[model samples]
Target chain A: LAKTTQPISMDSYEGQEVNITCSHNNIATNDYITWYQQFPSQGPRFIIQGYKTKVTNEVASLFIPADRKSSTLSLPRVSLSDTAVYYCLVGDVSNTGKLIFGQGTTLQVKP
Target chain B: DAGVTQSPTHLIKTRGQHVTLRCSPISGHKSVSWYQQVLGQGPQFIFQYYEKEERGRGNFPDRFSARQFPNYSSELNVNALLLGDSALYLCASSLIRVDNSPLHFGNGTRLTVT
Candidate 1:
């Protein structure tokens, strides 16, 4: 399991693009970086995932450098509903998919 | 398709008592994993079971145990519950073939220990 570090919280205005970066200096070669979002009283929901470079989906985009030591999740056109806790996880899914969640970055989207 | 479902959405127990939480996976998922989420903190992995076998175990104490039935449904048992045991228990299910497929999560069971 690769330990991840992220900002404790971030503030964003509606209609703005918000990018949250995570640092995993000890990422293993087989480890894949994944991001999840969680609202109050609910389980974390999958947002996006990437191994290297950039991967985009309907919801969000993931950017990983060649070193694979760090990654970022980009949310476009934010809204108050987008305000939630975001988690960055680096682990080998082939093993058990047992994710170790850190104190995620709380994104507060304001009007 | 229906997402993962957990029973007893809210539970209250006293110290030194026992409690059980149940989860039903998606229609075709064969893997079920359990996590503990405390207020103001991220979730902690507890156990993972695949094909009725234990696939992974986290750092949780032996007081916490789980099993997956042939149908892929799972049950988590906690004994000697303490106040610290109070937290939201999450159940996630996924197919075991692909390594990168995302796990579908249920709303979660909120257990409060008194």
Candidate 2:
């Protein structure tokens, strides 16, 4: 499993864009970068996933540089309801069931 | 089309006691995984089962064991529990064991050891 490092907490106001970066220097060639959002007292929800380049969905966008050693999750026009803990995981999702989650980045969306 | 579901949303047990937690995966999902989340920390993988067979096990002690039924439901059992066992037990399900198939998680069962 690739270890990931992220900010412990981030603060942002409504309508602003929030970007959280994760560093996985030991990422493997077969590993894919995935992000999940967890609200209080709830299970974490999948946000976006990518192997390289950029991938976007209705909720967020993931940008993986050419090196693939790091990735950033970009949230557009943040709102108070978007406040949650964001986790970045890198692994071979297809081959293994042991998905490792690190101490996620806590995003505080202020009103 | 319900998501993964866990039973006994909240439980309290004493040290040296045994407890069982149950989970029902989404319809048609064949893989189920269990995780333990301590307060203020990310979830830790405990076990994973696919088609009623154990696919992976975490670094947890033997006191923690799990089994999957033919219907793809799962049960996580803990024996001789300690205070450190208190945490949220989460169950996640996926349709298959391939690709980037994202896991669908349940609200989790909160266990408190006294």
- Candidate 2 CAPRI level: medium
Docking class of 1: medium
Q: Fraction of the real A/B interface contacts present in each candidate?
A: 0.70, 0.67
lDDT digits (tens) for residues A31-74 of candidate 2:
99999999988899989999999999999999999999999999
Candidate 1 local Cα displacement, residue B58, angstroms? 0.9
Supply candidate 2's per-residue lDDT for B59.
94
Q: Name the weakest run of 10 consecutive residues (lDDT summed) in model 2 chain B.
A: B94-103
Q: Write the per-residue lDDT of candidate 1 for residues A13-88, one digit (tens) a residue.
A: 9999999999999999888999999999998999998899999999899999999999999999999999999999
The i-RMS of candidate 1 is 1.1
Which TM-score value belongs to model 2?
Answer: 0.98
- Candidate 2: tens digits of C-alpha lDDT, residues B1-114: 788899999999999999999999999988999999999999999998998988889999999999999999999999999999999999999867567688888999999999
Question: Compared with the true structure, what per-residue lDDT tens digits does model 1 show for residues B23-91?
Answer: 999999999999999999999999999999999999999999999998899999999999999999999
Question: How far off is residue A17 in model 2, in Å?
Answer: 0.3
